[model samples]
Target: MNRQVERIFSQIDYLSSAPQADRYGLTKLKALRSEMERHRHEKYGLSEVISWAFRIKHALASQDHSDDWREGISWIGDPDASSVDRTLSYEYMRSDQKLVAGSIWNNYYPWIRRNGWSTIGSVHNSGMGAIATWILAVREVTKDSSQIVLLTTRLYFETRQLLQRLLFGTNVQVIECESDCEFLERIKEPTNSKVVAYLDSAEQSDSLSLFQRISSAPLPKPVVLVGWDNTLIPYWKNPVDSHTKLSAPLFLMRSLHKLDQLGLEVASAGLLTAASPAQLTPERARYLELLLSEVKNSMKVIGSTASPTTIRRLEAFRLPNADLAQDSNQAATAASDRFHDSISGVLPKYMEAVSYPHKVFVTIPLPGTNQESISKVMDQIVKQCTLSGLPVMRSPSVGYEFTSISSFLSESDTGDATRFLRVSPGGHDTDMIDEISQCFLSTVSNL
Candidate 1:
């Protein structure tokens, strides 16, 4: 069997074996399995759909844990109260409302037009979907089978894989750059083929600067910039615990407007909804409209001064760590100090930690410690927290596997890692922090 096909089947088997499979609806599972078998021979479309199905299943199964953990930390878990009914709420909304791809674009059109993009020609299922569509669109426009794609540093492993897979069987050249200087220098070279520059939050400012330079350059070939802003949403505030969000619509609007301003075409994607374009019905459109309205209202309540011209600045208001009336710099310093002190109270002696803007990453280094050992330690920590009714998440170390875009962009690498735990202080109080600290300490001491 093809390796990818085998992997897909393995994922289906894994989902089938999940203890909570029935909770996700056996009929849905059966239908997905049937579809998987029917499309086993398909190399492109089915492969992507199956891959996405694995993610959707995992997200659905993990909701209980995620909700409990988020609630313990005083963070918003399920904004829509989807978990109350034991149904995949997002999926239910998509299906029952008949939300499809076209409706998604239609609903987002107002936001897009307000942002200055007159029209978006196509829509895709996810951010990766948009990217794939964009790649093909570029190919069609340039009338060239070969092209060059420039990628910024710190791209996720899965994203890299998707790009490679999508670009396979073509002479497309992908170049990875570690710094702005390198990216700028490379694009300085002239060519008559399509050139796509992909940027993520890892280096947003730098990427934007490079993009501006590219837009202004007197090059012969068409230049387009694709931006991934999936992490821009306020997850800690309205954590509906759903995998999808308004990210696709937001990304589509932002990218299209920005690209149009530069006299270029753009393609973008986001993890906004699991439903495809074909699913958009009238009911689905209404549900999407309501969801987007709630999001905007929530932002307003949080004092987000975002407008169509400055939507990128939309973010949740973070409570100050310290009660100080000093200047901005002094207040910021005091807040950092207070946060570090709070984290120190919870971290185990076996672990050494560092704090970033939004979260803290703690590393536990034991003699001969490897990834497996670290994972065991993480499991123990999680178990203890669960027993004690605390909510915390196991996250990858900074500069390693899956750091947040802000952390990845702002922080420097201290060293490589076996495992690390990330703790966010958002929506958490001092007592809650101490309780979490005790949980970690207790687990480490017992070990």
Candidate 2:
């Protein structure tokens, strides 16, 4: 093993020896150690290295999953094994609860079901999966060519691109609607075609209002609301990096219920999967149990009540720049406010011409720089930040070049093909953000 890997393991051993070591932190450390061991000789690309670094940082920051380290380690040894080896020894365990079934069901499905809306079906996938599943569900519900309208903002370029790819050969007309009035008018227009509207709440701040409007509107067809609830700022509390919990299933279930109440036949999809049929060795089974337990524990820690009503109440108290501190709610809110203020104070210097739609993201367009030049600058900035122990994701532009909503949004249409640099705080505190800002300013000044 290299010195870096050895150093990480040593830190893990030291942290494990602590009187009250964080279980979650230890579990992540162990996992990272395993990953490093597996990929010791392999070379990692820039993206992979950045991803790994983020995972490591997150693992080191969280606690509460130490009990599952042994099981996780065992499963890591044979992840692809088809069945449990009896001779090797394993215990069978099952839960009617689908762990991957997003936070909506796990958190509030019971309440939602009690309200009269029943789940038709669900798919476990990412945001893209949710969109695809909804499209398929629409096709299944209405066995005729339909007009699919996507109500979304520029922030959801990746999602829009994915939707385009999925609906490429279909007869369905996928129209990207940014204006709420335009969407409402489109849905109101009488046609022989069934209209399926896909609304993304993740990218739009006024998503709840849009949802209310759509749910109340007298539309001829059902609206498939895409659950992008992962973008919620308050839920960014989990310290575990690679194990970011998926809550799309829960959102989908709730959305289905809500739309059903409005007399709409709705279907939903999320990033969580139903329980798999594959059997595991006793060790692996134990590991799986621990993993599920960790997720449940995380939900509790994050205060996920699962009920939409409760969630809405919680949303009322959400601070724009909440920190990852879990001890006292008051302290976290204070920290979050400070975090936001800190970034705001430093960002103006380098990001004078930037556009910030939300507190989490800042986008700056390089006036005269081409994509290649901007990319090089961004690579240097990322390397510097990573070296300084603060890694930020560097996206040249928010979305695909051809499918970019920049022109449609009229935000970055500077005549020249603009290359913009996007930055996020990524759970860092004031000092870290200041340091990063300084590094960014220095890099830009030099460039």
Candidate 3:
């Protein structure tokens, strides 16, 4: 049996062993089906679905003949499969051919559901994460070719430009609105341009008039209002005040920085090298170190260890922070303990003891949670990694909210919380960074 086919058969067996009625089982199957269909449709770049079809067929065959099932399964081996083997397993086919050949549509069907664009809440000194979030938000709102108007703070002019470059390229027209009145003039144009207003710098200034203008205008398309900085629109403030004035539906994202900055540093880690977990090996660690050394000074890596002891181990190798230290002596003594121990303590058991070839896994809570709170913590890690020039592999497990589960077995049989992992490599490939960052950020920015 082909090794790839054997692997699929293995997964089918693994999944089939579960009770058919299990929600998780169904979800896993659905996920697999979705992936297969995506590949078949060419929505995803690779055409691995052909091999997947073979695997599924082989699995069906095994199920049909018990003797072949056992004997065929027994033939599976090759623990460390080569990349070439994986890639060559599938040949390119036309999209229609792929769908038919891969047995898609028959089993898996996906649809487009209209989800409103996300609103970003905070835009302080926070860096790449904010920009990445904005880019994703822009991408979603502009999908139908809507025009976005940026209301930036003079203090954050550099940040604004940086964000524009990263998200929409340097040529993107960003009107720096100094006040509500100026924003009014730009939108007054008679053209039927789709309108998106951003409020980054003028959090303290009243947007009531601006909101009124938007509400009063017969917008040719949907209008989206994105605001950052909670202080601008305090929770105690009247939501009706803005809603009464605004013409379009109002969507607000609290804890803007955290909500906006998903997958910010994923690219700094590495690319998708393998579909399987990256084994932690000493040589891989050396390679990671090399990768870390190449990160720009402005960027940083944050490694979360499940074990606090491993954090201490990391601290042992930590370089001194000159800015935080009063003097060289103070810097050495104080900097060692200055790390937010509260943040470090949450490091999971797997994080601390895991070997080399670290794959960075990060998780985020459901959106509209305390984004600012988490953003502050993450920013620190990014800064530290950037300063140290160390590549931190992201673990997908980072963002899961843990909880205890009750079972029929016993209270003692409690298991860990279900979580998702976001894995990415750390290195200097600009194209890879662009891809990984865009993919990761796109997932959560809608939240």
Candidate 4:
């Protein structure tokens, strides 16, 4: 598998020079996908697959889409690789919509259906932006004053509160769930309530287990998982749609920024993916259609449609591994693990590091009982690293302390934090990560 990964990057350079570059690239990409599916159960192998996918993405992005597709619709080698850069307007955007919809249904959309992602919604790349608009769409479809909109992450509570009041205080009520139990409990008496959860923190590793519970239980409502974190690891099959129970409709609302395997940040990008036809029962299908319809209505009202450049970028950004493009640094596993071992894993008395998934960060307590304590530790680490002459984080995605890891009720969700100290080594290799880990350990142990 490691050889397969190395081979892709090695051969990737030759792709441009080869007689049939697209053919060569496509062949290798398909092979990589096959290997990914084979080793989907192993996390380490998944990391290799992502690195391979990242190389392919880099190669494709580097290639020049020299021809034009402005007047008429056409793509280079891959039909899904639709690329165009021009000023996009309402009419043009509508045309783009038709083109995108047609392409998805005609090409990869059906194929990706097995991967558990289909019915790509309008692209609204920002995390909060996509959530806000999707809420509006849900609002349009439901008049149930009793209908609950469960927001698992406290990060979105304020936004929902403002929208709740601003939109005439309709039947929809927003509830913030501190834990998965709270999320499930709040919606236990479900009429037509839905949930929107953001798996933004690496520390929150227990959400998938919770989803498994939700999938197995006789719950009626559906949950929409945003932020690219959920799909990073494969569970039963597809992280979102591969639920063995297949009880409720599962819709994935992803902030496209989280999709960058190389951890590249797109300033503006948003994608809301629909449920798989395989999992959608007639009742579930009806629910999905109504919500999707409202989502479109919300997007139309807000004028947050994606730009042509954005469309091009999004098309190029999507890798072929069934949207498993959640933000995971292949380096993060080793670096985060090393940081954890040196700090909380070995020494939990003076300092503690919250356990996280394969994400590229490790956090220590800022030393407060409130979730706020779990935040603002980045500043401390930055100061410590600067004082130690260590390199600052190379990754672009980071969070501020308005709400911290302590906000999560489940200790398993957030390892250990009165507050937290997040130290991430984005692309650093073994030697580099060892150095970075030592630097973090010294700074945190001293604190």
Candidate 5:
């Protein structure tokens, strides 16, 4: 085996020494070791390597089917599978919760019922935020018929450890698959419910089989493919790499585009992607602020006037705002109430009016109101959209406004009016509203 392969196998072997500490370690080692044994002679062959990886993955999976791991460490702290199964029965109440809550619980309770069959693929190593969001989304969407199955694969053991501890009642199926084919098969099973696959990686070619498998399968429910790497999709074929099989990136782009054509809007983190819905860390918020900065710059040239700069500054410089952090549940509740108020008050009039090509950024006026109140409102809205399989992402937050029309025009349009709105929310001519409406109508008429 090559030095890199050897190193990988060695690490896996070391982890196997403490099986309880590294439930996935044996699976990882089996794959690597099997690859080494098979490809010891081939100058150019990784098929054996791939098969070995699959073997180790299968071995680890077998362990999950039994109570052997209970003697080691509980990935999630509910004791046995029965404990997890029993909790779901009581947690998913149908008639009492809100729409978003019902939708989220419906997504997760199925996996919980099936002894946790969800297999989640995280492209980035630091994707705890997204994972956390999934947990919250699942908890809120459970139903009597909910039989959720969820799973995850990560490169870091530490991340898995942290996740097991922080996420309450997460008993999803998890296995380590080092190859693309394995990932495809895990998601290719038959089900009449929602099935999701998260494919985020820079090497799209490696996952070509994944896209093919997904495409071939006759799915009964919605399947979401989460993409993160911008470079994975190759727009045009290059003569040099043409011999390579169809790339995962290109395949995914094509697949998603096709799905979009079929009337399915792919969901993304949207404005609330900073950290998962459950935990928004300062470090993570700052990292997203940087990404949002770039997104804002891209918008300035062609897209809408989504002020990524202002949102980034707000999230980065001022997070866990003291006023907002007093009680997490309460903050979320208040935010929801205020958000409905804002949307009900705005959408009717706002929809009737013309708008510049900018995203709607609502900011709650801050006096006694905490920043979390506004953030929470936006968060709820974004999560709601995500659950319904809609795209509500890469949005920005503008400051508060006296009126919805002004907020819409101010964020999107450029001209004397833009400056006027920003500098004088009150002093602008009252006729500006009429002018704004006419301008918006004229633009839409052309479209």
Candidate 6:
């Protein structure tokens, strides 16, 4: 009778006792999650889907009734439309389309604002394009041909490297510091060039102090703070003490692919400027204006314009965005809590001490003196997870070497031969989480 199992049953029993409407909503949520999971693995990414949506939107708006246009395109139009204006619509749909996508924004900006993040800009792009747009905008506004970019997010070594090469070599130089201490030190470097720093997650215990330091520190150049998934769930705000207002321009990048549980996967990405629902300082206000123009312009330059279809769908969706993030957070909390509870006193047996670092995931560092042993344990965990039918993954945060989540520790300290695994139960059912918790607990206990 594990407490985790009892908790799962309680949740189920409560659901059974709840009003019919709540149950229906929960059912719809699960269906949406299932659909999202299915489509994410599709060959056609949201970007390409956006292209098709644009082409369709263009065709419907065009006055061209010529034979070439008619012969080239094969799409059925709305029956009531006149000959001159075609109303071609996407054929792919779920019977529950409106019920699912019609309300994704039910939570909307309020959820973000409630969580101490403000909406930065009025425009957006899709997927990773949102982040790229933010970076490009920062580079453009700074007007520094050779500028410094500080990355403090806990991402894979490969992901960090990709950022460095995103632009021309001389345009933007990315500095991947081993710790926030280095970031804090480097931010003070003498440079008139506009500096853009990326910070992520509450995983780092020092995030609040870092923010306070950034606020008081006299930065050489105007600095802008940016992050992805920060649109709703952020590594930007310190979980312990969320300070809504800041001295700098804050741009939260969003990709709803994973954020919005409603499966819109709108391939929609947005460059949010302010940590919204709050008043902006005169300085942050000016920087916000600078970025709006640059981010929108960069999207145009890269042919990464925001998808009109996705926008309409997101706006029209019935569910709240706040609900999506909240539910996802709840799931992560339950999973993480269960993991820690299961392994409570026995963690030291097989691994270094671990703790819940993020709302969406937890890191468990495998104890090892070399790469081979760390990798072997990782493989064992994966095998165990697979055999148990748990959807555990090798996350970017769990680097075998030279990688860390939120740089919680120095590279020299944990980067050599240690490897950690990131596990979370976001978007999972409560009962399934119970099973996952038990399975992983067993796997670790035996180790």
Q: What TM-score would every model get versus the actual structure? A: 0.42, 0.49, 0.27, 0.61, 0.23, 0.54
Residue-wise lDDT of candidate 5 within 1-447, one digit each (tens)?
123333555544433313243343323332433445555433211233333433333333334324443332222122234522322232222111111322222222121223222211211111233343333333333222234444232223333454355444644333434445666656656765433344332121243334334434333232322222111222121212212222111111111111110111111111112112122245333333443343323223322221222122122112212221122122222322333333333333423222111111122222222344434543543454445443232222111111121111111212111111111111112343233323323332232
Q: How close is candidate 3 to the true structure, as a TM-score?
A: 0.27
Evaluate all candidate structures by whole-model CA lDDT and list the values in order. 0.36, 0.36, 0.29, 0.46, 0.28, 0.45
In model 2, the Cα lDDT at residue 276 comes to: 18
Question: Which whole-number lDDT from 0 to 100 does residue 263 have in model 2?
Answer: 11
lDDT of 6 by residue, 59-153 (tens): 33333324432221111221112321221122332111111222222223543445654443433455456666666777766554455555564
Question: Taking the tens digit of each residue's C-alpha lDDT, what string does model 4 give over 1-447?
Answer: 223434656654443323243454434544544565665533232345545544555444444445543211112223433233221234654233433445431232332466544555456646455666666766665665355454554333335344555456676555545655665565455445554443322344365555555556455544532222243332113344444554444455445454332443423555555554455556556666777777777766766566565555444333323334322333345555655565555544645566555444555554544544333444555665667655453233421100011222223235432444445544434454455566656655554
Task: Write down the lDDT that model 2 would get.
Answer: 0.36
Q: 286-392, model 1: which lDDT tens digit per residue? A: 43354344433322332222121111101000111011111212222333334457556455565555653322232333434555765687677777777777645
lDDT of 2 by residue, 32-100 (tens): 334544543312211232234333333433433346432221232222233212212112121122223
- Where is model 2 more than 4 Å wrong at Cα? 1-11, 14-125, 136-143, 146-155, 184-192, 201-208, 212-358, 367-372, 386-418, 445-447
Off by over 4 Å in 3: 1-131, 140-155, 168-171, 203-205, 212-229, 242-245, 249-447
Q: How accurate is candidate 1 locally (lDDT)?
A: 0.36
Question: Which segments of candidate 6 are over 4 A away from where they belong?
Answer: 1-108, 111-127, 143-159, 171-173, 185-193, 201-209, 212-245, 262-271, 274-287, 303-319, 344-353, 365-420, 426-434, 441-447
Question: Per-residue lDDT of 304-398 in model 3, one digit per residue for the tens?
Answer: 10121111111111111111111212211221122212123334433221111111212222222343533443444444444544333322211
Worst 10 residues of 6 by lDDT: 399-408
Q: Is candidate 1 or candidate 5 better by lDDT?
A: 1
Give the winner by TM-score: 1 or 4. Answer: 4
Winner by TM-score between candidate 6 and candidate 1: 6
